[model samples]
Target: MARIRVQNLVKAWGDFRAVDDIDFETNDGEFVALLGPSGCGKSTTLRLIAGLDQATSGQIFIDDRDVTQVAAAKRNLALVFQSYALFPHLSVADNITFGLSVRGVPRAERERRLEKTASLLGVTALLGRKPSQLSGGQQQRVALGRALISEAPVCLLDEPLSNLDAKLRAEMRNEIRTLQQRLGITMVFVTHDQTEAMSMADRVILMKSGKVEQCGTPAELYENPASTFVAGFIGTPPMNLVAAAPKDGRLAVAAAASSDLVLGVRPEHIEFAGEGQEAVVAGSEYFGADTVVACRIGEQKLMVRVPGRPGLGTGAQVRLAWAPSNEHAFDARSGLRKSA
Candidate 1:
C-alpha cells in the first residue's frame, strides 16, 4: 500500500546528533523494525519518518512522493505511541473516532469506520468504557483501533509493546503482525528488544550511537553480524567474544598472535568435547529447556548454551570445541568483521 524511504536523514541538537545520516527504505506492505538500545536514535528515526519531528537534513519519500515538508496530518500516516495516548475523559468509541470528527468526516462515516476498526481489533464491546476503565492490553487495542480507523496505508509504532507485561507483549506482537498483513499496510516499528524485532520484522535496521550499524533480515543478522557490537546485541545469550591469536596457521584462544584480533562464537555453537581448547567452568544458569554455561578460557569469559543440565560445578575443567566454519573473526580495534 505504501513504501517509505529516508535518505541521508539527520537530526541534531547543537553538538549532539540523535539521528545521523541514516538511509533505509521499506517495501510496500512490508514490516520493518528500527532496533537498538536506549539513546540509539531508533525512536528519533521513527519520529522523523512520521513527520512528528523535522529532520536537520535529508529527504523523506512515501510511495515515491517527496513528503519532507508535509505536515504530520497531511502525510496520510497513522501513528501509535508507546504510551497509548488515549484521552481518559473520552469513551473508547469517541476516542477512536476523534480524528475523524476533527477532520469533519460525517458522523455516519465516522461510526461506520469505527465499527469496522473495533471489530478488526476485537474492541467493539469496550466502546462505551473510558481509557481508565480498560486494562493495559485493552487500552492498547483501543489505541490500535484509533490508528487503523483512519485506513492510512502507512503506520508508525513507537515501542508499542514496552508497557505491557511479557505475556501481553507476546500476544500483541502476533496480533499486530497479523493485522499488518491482513490490511496490507506498511509499518515501521521501533523497539530495543531483539526478540521483537527478529520475530516480527521482514527486515531489521539496527542502530547504535545515532548511526546505522546493520540492516538485514533476521537470519542474515544472526548468521553474519557486521561488527562485534552486533554480535553481542542480537542474541539471547549473545555471542561470546574472546581474545584470540594465530596458532598452527589457525586462530586459537590465548595463543600468541595479534592482540587486536578477536574471535566470536555463538553460545549454541560451542560444545564440550574430549579434546579441544581447555576452559574452566565459572557457573551455569538452567532455563528448563537448556542451560547457559559460563566458562573461562584463561581470563576471558565465554557463555556456552547446551541442551539440558550438564550439572558441572564451578572450577570444573572442560574441553570446548566448535566447527571452524562457525567461528567469526573481527578486528579488535575497529570492531569490524574480518574477511575470511
Candidate 2:
C-alpha cells in the first residue's frame, strides 16, 4: 500500500471554505476514518485526496509522490461509493471486470484477479446474479470485489455500509476490517457515523465546521479529548458535561460566583455514593444490555449508564459520585479541555 500525506489542505468556494487548512498523515496499510457530521467537510477532504476535486491551496502526497494536481484516473486509488454504484443491467461478474476490461487487461489475468477477489469477499456464486437479484450485503460484497480486483494500493470508501440494515452493517464492518487487514491495503474511510468510524478505523480524524477538531486513536479521543466538542461527540450516551463551580471543596452546578470550569464525566463512570453530589433521577432509557439513567442536578442534566437495570426511577433522590480521576475538567467559556 501507500502512505498518504495532506499538507495545509484547503478547499474553498467563493468566500466559504469547505475544508480549512488541515494536515494529517496515514502510514502504509493504515486504516484512517474521516469522521464528522454532515457539512463538516469530511467528504470534501476525501475528494481532494482522490483527485476528484482540486485543493484551493495545498499539497497531497501518496507514497511521497506529489499528486495534488494529478488526474483522478491516474491516482491508482479504488473508490467504493455509498450507493455501491453497481450497474443494474450488468451481471456481478461483468460489473467487477468492467475496470479491467476498459484497460485492456488480458482475459486470463482479469479472470485470475476476479477469482481471487470473489473468493476473498465470499461472492463467487454471486457472479451470475444481477444487482437486482442480490441482497444489500451481497451487493456490497460485489462492490467491494470490484474495487479489490483493481488491486489499487489505496482504497477509499464513502459510507460504504450506510445503505445496509443495522445487522448487515455490523457484519460488513467486521468483514471489511478483516479483509482490509488481510490485504494490507491502505484505507481511507469517510462516514458521519461515529460508531462506524470508532469501531472500524485504526485512527479517527474528527472534523467540525470544516476544521479538524481532533485526530487520534479511538481510545485517545474518547479518554483525552482536546476540546469540549470532542468530548461530547465521541462517546455512546456521550460524556456528561455540566456547568459548575467549586463549592465547599466539591463541585456544584453554580454558586454566587460561578467558576469558569465545567465538570465532565462519562455515563458509565458515574455511580451511587453515600457522599457526593446530590441529584434526582429524571428518567431512564433501557437498552438490551444496559440502562441509562437521566439525572438532574440543579438546573443541569447528566446521564448515568448502569449495567443490567438500575433501581433509580423518576424523581428519586440519589447521591452521584465518580472516581476523582474520572472527572474531566474543561473551560466553560472556551469549550476546551482544561489541564489536569
Candidate 3:
C-alpha cells in the first residue's frame, strides 16, 4: 500500500482551468473518493494522478516519492476506466494478463497471477469467454482483474460501476470495497454519484467549479456540511434550505429573510407536530419504506420524510417541527455555513 499526496494541483487548457489549486492526501490502504457533479474536475484530477493527463502546475507524490513528471507507465499505478476498455479480440484471461505480457513477464508468472486474480474476483469461469459474450457485471470483473493482476500499491477507478444497473452497482460496490481491504491497496475512486462516494470511501473530497469544496469523512460532511452546496448535495432528497430570519437570537424560516440567512434541515429531521410553523402540503411521494411530503411555508418549500405513507393530500395544512440541534444555518449572501 502507498500514501498519495497532491499539492496545489492545477490543470488548465487555454484560458479554462479544469482543476484549480487542489490539495489533499490519502493514507496508506485508505479508500478515498473524489466526488462532484459533471465538469467539476474529479475525472481530470484522477487522470492527472494516473499521469494520463499532466498537471499544469503542482506536485504529485506517491509513497513519499515525487511522481509528477513521471510517465503514466512508469508510475506503477493501475487504472480501471469507466468504459471497462476490454479488447474485443482478447479472452478474459488474456485481457487480465496483457499488462504482464507487455512488460515481458514470464508466461508461468502470468498464469499464476491470472489464476489468483480470477479466483479473487470470482471470474475464473468467465476467463475463457470474450468480453462481448459476458454480462456487464462480468465484464466489470474482468476489468478489475486486469488492474488487480498488477498488484500495484495504488489503484485508481473512474466511475467503475457507472455502466451497471442499480442492483449490480450495489453488489460491485461491496465487492470492490472488500477486495481493497483484503489486499490493503490504496484506492482513489472518482464518481459523480453521492451515494457511491458516501457509502464506499473512507474519506470524500467534494469538488465544485474545478476546486475542492470540502474534504472529510462521509459522516463529517453529512453531519457538519461546510456550505450550502454540501448541505444540498450530500443527502438523498438533500437538505431543505429555506429563507430564514433572525428571531430572538435564533433563525426561523421566512420569505423576507431570503436576503440575509438560510436555514437548513434534512427531510428526515422534520416531523409533523400539533403546533409549530404552519405549512401547506404541496405534494407527496411515497416510497415503499417512507414518504416524502412537500410543504410550502410562505414562499419557501421543504420536504419532510416520514415513515410509511403519510397520505397527506395536496392543499392539506400541517405544522412542522424539528429539533434545534438538527437545524443548520448559513449566510445567504456567501452561502457559507455559520459557525457555532
Q: Pick the candidate with the highest TM-score.
A: 3
Task: Return the TM-score for each candidate structure.
Answer: 0.97, 0.96, 0.98
What lDDT is reached at residue 127 by model 3?
A: 89
Error of model 2, residue 281, in angstroms? 0.9
Colliding pairs, model 3: none
Off by over 4 Å in 2: 247-252, 255-259
Report how far residue 178 has shifted in candidate 2, in Å. 0.1
Candidate 2 clash pair list: none
Query: Any idea what lDDT model 2 has?
Result: 0.90
Clash count for each candidate, listed in order shown: 0, 0, 0
Per-residue lDDT for 155 in model 1?
A: 95
Ranking by lDDT: 3, 1, 2
lDDT (tens digit, per residue) of candidate 1 on 1-340 = 9999999999999989999999998899999999999999999999998999999999999999899999999999999999989999999999999999999999999988988999999998999999999999999999999999999999999999999999999999999999999999999999999999999999999999999999999998999999999999999899988889877766788744347999999999999999989999999999999999999887788899999999999999999999888899999999999999
Candidate 1: stretches off by over 4 Å: 255-258
lDDT of 1 at 99: 93
- TM-score pick, better of 1 and 2: 1
Lowest summed-lDDT stretch of 10 residues in model 2? 249-258
- Top model number, lDDT: 3
lDDT of each: 0.94, 0.90, 0.94
How do all the candidates rank in terms of TM-score, highest first? 3, 1, 2
